[model samples]
Target chain A: AQSVTQLDSQVPVFEEAPVELRCNYSSSVSVYLFWYVQYPNQGLQLLLKYLSGSTLVKGINGFEAEFNKSQTSFHLRKPSVHISDTAEYFCAVTHMNTGFQKLVFGTGTRLLVSP
Target chain B: DVKVTQSSRYLVKRTGEKVFLECVQDMDHENMFWYRQDPGLGLRLIYFSYDVKMKEKGDIPEGYSVSREKKERFSLILESASTNQTSMYLCASRSGLAGGLYEQYFGPGTRLTVT
Candidate 1:
């Protein structure tokens, strides 16, 4: 079974400060990695995804993530966060060869960005 | 742009009531999914459908069922509402092409509260 793990439950940061949300996954076979952000009372929006090419993936809103094959980790990062970036971020993984896209998601990390 | 829409943004139901959550996608994607989001639990897939009249159970599917009668619509059913079932419900759809972006587009989400 594919599983995703996000170590931090919450991370507090001030405006203009950099932030990193760590994610790790356990899967025997190759998997697709994704980052999603959920704003208050809304659904999740895809941030970035790492499929087969270049491990360094850049996503919307100046967000990016690196897929480390050896470490089995995909970590999201932002050089400088804004107050509007405060939201719950999730890391997800899915089997690469499956026709059905059943994503296994992490528990989530709440990014608390304050001014 | 693909658009996934849920039937309700917020719902209040009493325990034991039968609940129906509907999701529709504008794009003709072949895969649809239902997920529930809870604090510290992120999003856990309850069910997914790869085609009409086809459904598959996810990580958690004890009290839930799903329907897909049309190519663009998927419905989730809660047999009997319970307090434990109260949470933000999200619906997502993805393309089934062999090698596509395969990113799931999500709806605005339905916040269901069972009393």
Candidate 2:
């Protein structure tokens, strides 16, 4: 079975500060990585995904993530964050094989951006 | 835009009552999934359906069941509601592999409270 682990539970940062949320996964085969963000009382929206090629993947809202195959990590990063970026972020993984194509998500990291 | 909608935004149910959570997608996606979100524990898949009347148990499907009578609609059924089952329920839909990398579109989610 595959699983995703998000190391940080909560991150507090001031506005315009750089942020990086760490994520690691355990899977035997090739897998796809994704980052999602959820605002207060709202559903999750896809931030970015790494399907194939390009270890450095860019996402919405001026965010990016680097897929490290050697370390089995896909960490999300942003050059600077705004107060509106305060939300819950999740990292997910899914295998590329056939079957149900179920996605496994991490415990989530709460990004608290204060002005 | 792919739109997935849940039947209720919030629901209060009594213990031992039967609960049904409905989800509908307007994109005519081939796959539908039901998940439960809890604090400190990200989204856990309960059930998923790849096609009409075709359902599969996910990572945690102990006390939950699901139904997919049509291609665009999926319903989650809780046989006996319990306090521990109170959490945010999310529904998602995704197209098959034909469209290259499949990305799941999520609904607004239904917050269920069992008392």
Candidate 3:
């Protein structure tokens, strides 16, 4: 079973400040990584994903994540964040070998961007 | 654009009552999923259907059942609602085509309250 772990529960930053939410996963085989964001009262939307290409993956809303196979980490980062960027972010993983295609998610990290 | 819609945004039900949550996807996706979200716990998959009449239990599916009579619609059922089951329910859909990474698209979610 693959599981994701988000190190930080909450991160508070000022507007325009850089932010990083740490994520680590445990899997026995090759896996795909994804980041998702959930705004208030809304479902989650995909931020970015890492399949098999470059280690550095860029996502929507000016966000990016780096996939480090050695450390088993896929941390999400944003150089400059806005007040609108404040939301709950989740890190998910799925194994590439199976066709089941089930995603295992982390506990989530709440990013609070203040003015 | 892919659109996943739930039948309700908010629902209130009493204990032991039968509850049904409906989900429909417009993109003709072959895979549909049901998940529950709670604070401090990210989305946990309750059930998923890869095709019509084919359903699979996810990590947590003890009190939940699902129906997928039609390809575009998947329904989650709570045989007897409990307070522990009160949470935000999310529905998602994805394509099952081979050779392409399937990204799950989510709905706005339905907040269910079991009193």
Candidate 4:
């Protein structure tokens, strides 16, 4: 079974401050990683995804993530965050080789960006 | 643009009532999914369909059933609405093979509240 773990439940940051949301996954086979963001009372939107090549993947809203194979981590980061970036972020993974291709999602980390 | 749309943005239902959540995709996607999002639980897949009349149970499918009579539309049915079933229901669609690398397009979501 593939599972994703997000270490933090909530992260508070001021505007223009750097933010990092950590995510780790446990899967025996090759996995595809993804980041999604959801605003309050809204559905989730895709941020970035790491399918195969280029571990360092950049996403919308100036967010990026690095997929570390050995560590089994895909952490999302941004140099500076804006107030509009305040949302719930989720990390998801799906096994590439497994026939059951449903995405396993993390518990989510609420990023609270304030001015 | 690939667009996934849900029939209702917000719904309030009474306990023990039957509930239906509708989702439609405009992109002729072969795969469709239903997920529920809760605080601290993120998104958990309830069901998915790869083709019309084909459905697969996801991690949490005990209280949910799905219908895919058409290629572009998927409907989730809750046999008996319970307070525990109150959460944001998300619909997604993808246009490729099951195990291949493809990002899912999400709908605006239907927030279901069972009181």
- Most DockQ-accurate candidate: 4
State how far residue B3 of model 2 sits from its true place (Å).
Answer: 0.4
* Residue A19 error, candidate 3, Å: 0.5
Residue-level lDDT of model 1, residues B1-115, one tens digit each, is: 8999999999999999999999999999998999998888988889988889999999899999999999999999999999999999999999878633588899999999999
User: A74-103 in candidate 4: lDDT tens per residue?
Assistant: 999999999999999999998877475778
DockQ of each: 0.65, 0.64, 0.67, 0.72
Give the per-residue lDDT of model 4 (tens digit) for B1-115. 8889999999999999999999999999899999998888888899999999999999899999999999999999999999999999999998856464788889999999999
Docking class of 3: medium
The better candidate by TM-score, 2 or 4, is: 2
**Candidate 2 or 3, higher DockQ?**
3
For model 4 chain B, the run of ten residues with the poorest summed lDDT: B95-104
Tell me which of candidates 2 and 4 scores higher on lDDT. 2
Report per-candidate TM-score of chain A alone: 0.96, 0.97, 0.97, 0.97
For model 3, residues A10-87, the per-residue Cα lDDT tens digits are: 999999999999999999988889999999999899999999889999999999999999999999999999999999
**Runs in model 1 lying further than 4 Å from the true structure:** A97-99, B99-101
Point out the higher-scoring one by DockQ: 1 or 3: 3
Question: Which candidate model has the greater DockQ, 1 or 4?
Answer: 4
In terms of TM-score, which candidate is stronger, 1 or 3? Answer: 3
TM-score of chain A of 3: 0.97
Binned by DockQ into CAPRI classes (incorrect, acceptable, medium, high), candidate 1 is: medium
